[model samples]
Target: MRSMTRRNRLMAAIKYLVCAIMILVIAVPLYISVMGGLKSVGQLRAEPVSLPNPVNWNQYTDMLTGKNGSFWPKLVNSVVIGLGTVGVILIIGTFAGYALARIKFKLNGLIYAYFQLGLLFPLAVAILPLYLQLRSFHLLDSAIGVILPQAAFGLAMMLMLLRGFIKAIPLELEEAAAIDGYSRFGFLFRIVVPLSTPILATVSVLTLVSSWNNFFTPLLVFNSEKKYTLPMGVMNFMGEHAADWNLILAYLTLAMIPAVIIYVLCQKYIVAGLTGGAIKG
Candidate 1:
């Protein structure tokens, strides 16, 4: 019994050690970045790992309202694109997920398999064709160009996630609503949608993050400075004289703020949405 107790204690100690190490690994770089952002170029180079002695604030201010155009507009662009992408994904994903989960149709499984197959195609492989297609429609360098492709790419995964969650919901609810003279659309809107808020929030958060962070798509589609998204705007910080490492880190941190806020605000829904179906099944 004493030996068993000792073994358990040993395991507990190891677990704590492992957790501490993991935290340190994740936190150290973030700390460095934050500290670096707070330092001058010279100070940063001299003491890259050290905490800011006096805590400089110029980096953030300069980055926010620098001569190369204010970051506010770029920030707004990111928000708009992110929100637009989420809206499109939600509308399409909800309906498709519901169909896949409940409706009987020919080759449903095969159709869904095709969607799964889409996930295998890397974005790089399709860039040239996508650009050509968008160009034909005069959508190249346009916001809609970025939005449509993102929505299309995101649909498959969103459908799979929401479909799994929807499957866990009992079909009797739909039948009951139908008997009450609710049209199919009404039943879907009033019943399934209201109940699926958790998953919807999860997908919304995911879609927003993905769209906001997307760089390559925006780089390819948007040529005008005014329409550039946050990631692309950050790229402009790069230069010869002084790489503006301070400003770069500051902008990077700022770029991440929205995603972090969103995740924190909707975390409970995300967790519940992701896990609810798993446990129920």
Candidate 2:
């Protein structure tokens, strides 16, 4: 018994050690990025890992308020695109997920499988064709251009997440809703929606973050620099300020703020939704 206890202690120590290392691996780079952004170019070069001798806020301030300001526009573009993408995913994905979950059909499995197959193909594979198609429809350089394709790519995964969660909802709830004079659509909107809050938050956060950080789609879709999203804005900022590592780091740090805040706020739902879908599905 003593030997078994010793073995368990050793395993626990190893697990803790591994977790600490993983945290450092993720946290160290982030620390450096934030710290490095607060230094002068010379200070950053001389002491890359250390805290700023005097915290500098110029780069961030300029990005926010200068006449040469481009960051705010990019930030707005990202927000609009992210929200639009999430709205599309939740609306379409919810309806589709509900149908797949509750409505019986011969091709139900096949249709769901078709959407799953979309997971196998990343956007890079279809960029050329997607570019041409977007051009044909005159979607280039528009918010709708970025939002539509981003939303499409996101739908499959959202459906995957939402379908499982909706399926786990008790049928008796629907029966109760029906008996109350609620139609099918009414039951879905009124009952299923409120009950599915966890999964909805999960989907919104996932879609929002993915859309917020998307570089390739925006890079290809927007020709006008004015319409560039944060990721593209970062790249352009880097090119214009190649020698200014501090400024670049500042831009990166600022860009990371929104997504980080969002994820932290919605993290609990992410865990609950994923677990609920997994256990119930």
Candidate 3:
């Protein structure tokens, strides 16, 4: 009995240690970024690790007020693209997911396999071809250009997640609805979607984060200053002659806030959605 008790205690201690290490790993960088953002360029250079000797709000002030550049417009552009991409993903992915989950068709498995294959194709591999296609359509510097590719890349994952969730929902519900005279579209929008809110929220949050943090796609497609996304615009803070580390960190700090807010707000749904479909389907 004593041995078993000792072993359990030791395991608990180890778990606590692991948790503490994980927290430190995550928190340290975030702390550094926030504190670094509050420091001036000189303070950052002089005392890299120390707390700002005199807190400098200029980094944030300059960015927000557009003294350095039009940070607000860049932020607005990011919001537009990110939200637009999520809207497209949700509308299209929900229906596609419902079909994959419930509707039977020839070679449906093969079609799904192709969608899954997209996950394997790294973004780098398709960048060149995607650039050519976008240029041909005159979409190279447009928000629509960014939105379409982001939605396309996200659809596979969204469909995969939502399909599993939708499948987990009992088919009897749909049958009952059908007997009550609910049309196909009606059943989907009215019944399936309501039940799948958890997963929908999850997918929405994930899509928002992915679209917001998209640097490479925006970099390749959007060259105009007016159309710059947050991630791409952060690069502009770095000058060729000298990079402003404090300002760059401030931009990064600001960039991360919206994603964090969305995640925290919807994390409960994300968890429920992920687990609700695992084996129930």
Candidate 4:
């Protein structure tokens, strides 16, 4: 009994140590970025970890006030792209997921396996071909250019998550709705939708975050500075203010705020959604 108790204590200590390490790993950089942004360029370099001597707020204000900056435009672009990607994913993914999970068909598994293959090939592998296709479609420098590809790539994962959750939904509900004069589409939109909210929220949050952080895809698709997304705005800071570490850090902190806010607000839903998808379906 003493040996078992000792082993449990050791394991608990190890777990706590790992958790503390992970928190530091994430929190330290965030701390540096926030503090660094409030310091002057020289102060940032000289006293990297020290609090700001005079607390320079110009870097952030300059970004927000658009003092020769494109922060607002870049932020708006990210919002548009993120929302659009999520919308497309949810719309198409729901139908596709429902069909795959609920319908009986011979080619269903084969079609699903084809989508599963997408998981093996990351987007970078098809960049050149994707560029060519976008150019041919005259979608270059357009939000749709970024939105469509992101949605398409995201569809696979969305389908996977949604399929399990949708399958877990009781079929008897559909029969009851059918007797009440609910059409198939009506039943899906009305009944299934409410029940599947958790998984859908999960897919939305994931796709939105992915679309917001996608730098390369937007870079490849958009050539115009006006159409540039937030990630691109980060690169601009690195280039234009290369020597000004404080300015760059300010930009990083500001750019990260929205996504951070989103994650914080929806984190509970994310956990619930993922759990529901995994265990129920």
Top candidate, metric TM-score:
4
Q: How well is each residue in 1-281 modelled by candidate 4, as lDDT tens digits?
A: 99999999999999999999999999999999999989998897799988999999898899899994688999999999999999988998999999999898999999999987877789999899999999999999999999999999887778888888788898999989999999989999999889988788888988888899999899999988889999998897689878888888988999999989998999987676567545653
lDDT of candidate 3 over 57-85, digit per residue (tens): 98888877887766789889999998999
Taking the tens digit of each residue's C-alpha lDDT, what string does model 2 give over 1-281?
A: 99999999999999999999999999999998898888999999899999999999887788779544488889989999999998988888899999999999999999999998778889899899999999999998899998999988987778888888788899999999999999999999999999998789888987887898898999989988899999999899899989899999989998899988987888886676557545654
Error of 4 at 19 (Å): 4.3
> Which segments of model 4 are wrong by more than 4 Å?
1-21, 271-281
- Alpha carbon deviation, residue 266, candidate 4 (Å): 1.5
Return the TM-score for candidate 3, rounded to 2 decimals. 0.87
Task: For model 2, state the Cα shift of residue 201 in Å.
Answer: 1.3
Model 1 lDDT tens row, 143-239: 8899888998988778877888788788888889989999988988999999988788888877887898899899989988889998888776554
Return the lDDT, model 3, position 40.
82
Question: How does candidate 2 score on lDDT?
Answer: 0.88
Candidate 4 RMSD computed on C-alpha atoms after optimal superposition onto the true structure: 2.8
**Each candidate's lDDT (Cα)?**
0.82, 0.88, 0.84, 0.89
Runs in model 1 with CA error above 4 Å? Answer: 1-7, 65-69, 240-242, 269-281
Candidate achieving higher lDDT, 1 or 4: 4
